[model samples]
Target: MNLEDYGEGTLASAPLDVLEDYFAAHGWQSERNGDEEIVAAVKGSWTQYELRAVWRAEDRVLQFLALPDVRVPEDKRQLVYETFGLINEQLWLGHFEMWAASSMILFRHAALLDSASPAGLTLQQAETLIEAALDECERFYPVFQFVLWGDKTPQEAIAAALVDTAGEA
Candidate 1:
């Protein structure tokens, strides 16, 4: 279905379709996973990142996840864990997590829709979340590289990744 189908003020009850359509409209490749999930992929400088959106009908929440291609080495798990705390605190939306079993790191964000209606679940909101997730991934990826390969401390890595824009404004 197209985005225009859900006009302003109308409840976007189909969370999965809405997410899929929104991503597809932006030229991102997307596909359904089983019944409740849609996975979309976008290319980045380092690698391709997979963004997954899962619709929880019962809870009325759409969960967005972006999995970077980088995997934390077993030896550097502790360092990465510590770095995640620093990164998460600076974030205004979503958080980073590591899956021990798979040795993979992921960025996740979620939006809760009104159970009675989709008053706040607009296409613009969905796009904003996806854009934020991707931006966060791009920004922090180098920090992970520093911890894993450059043997830098979390503080050093964060400091290196941060860009000072005090005078630009």
Candidate 2:
């Protein structure tokens, strides 16, 4: 995505197409953006998680599906936003709800990764976790229905495989 090109202090909002291109290049797909929201899928090993880039007053922000359920520390969310070149403070200002901005899930993911909980995550289990997370994401943020990262089948297949693996385990 060459996010470095955007740099800091750029007042211009990242166009939806540009965001799509960046995510697409990373193997993300099935993007759906409307007047108020943008949604897509992301690949995590063998599973896919839904990612929502909600528009906040013409500025684009990220929100993940099913992240509210994940426990994470504060400050981590802001780092995720920084990684994408979005101002985390702007997205979080005055928003008391976790789902209102993209930071919460990112923070949780970061915490999880840092803590090594995501290590040794099988493809099937990973898909199941992402699916569960997306369910929460949809419940909290309904304006999402895009496919980014990998195709829908891989996600479903990973989920199914996880279920089978669980039975065996």
Candidate that would win on TM-score? 1
* Model 2, runs deviating above 4 Å: 1-14, 58-169
Mind giving the per-residue lDDT tens digits that candidate 2 earns over 60-81? 3333232333322353444332
- How well does each candidate superpose onto the true structure, as a TM-score? 0.87, 0.30
CA shift of 13, model 1, Å: 7.0
Q: Give the TM-score of candidate 1.
A: 0.87
Cα deviation at 111, candidate 2, in Å, is 19
Off by over 4 Å in 1: 1-13, 118-120, 165-169
Which prediction has the highest lDDT against the true structure?
1
Per-candidate clashes, comma-separated: 0, 11
lDDT of 1 by residue, 1-169 (tens): 5445655655434677777778778899898876579898999877799999887767778898999998988899999999999999999999999988999999998988775544335677777888999999999999998898999999999888786767654
Quantify all predictions' global Cα lDDT against the true fold: 0.84, 0.36
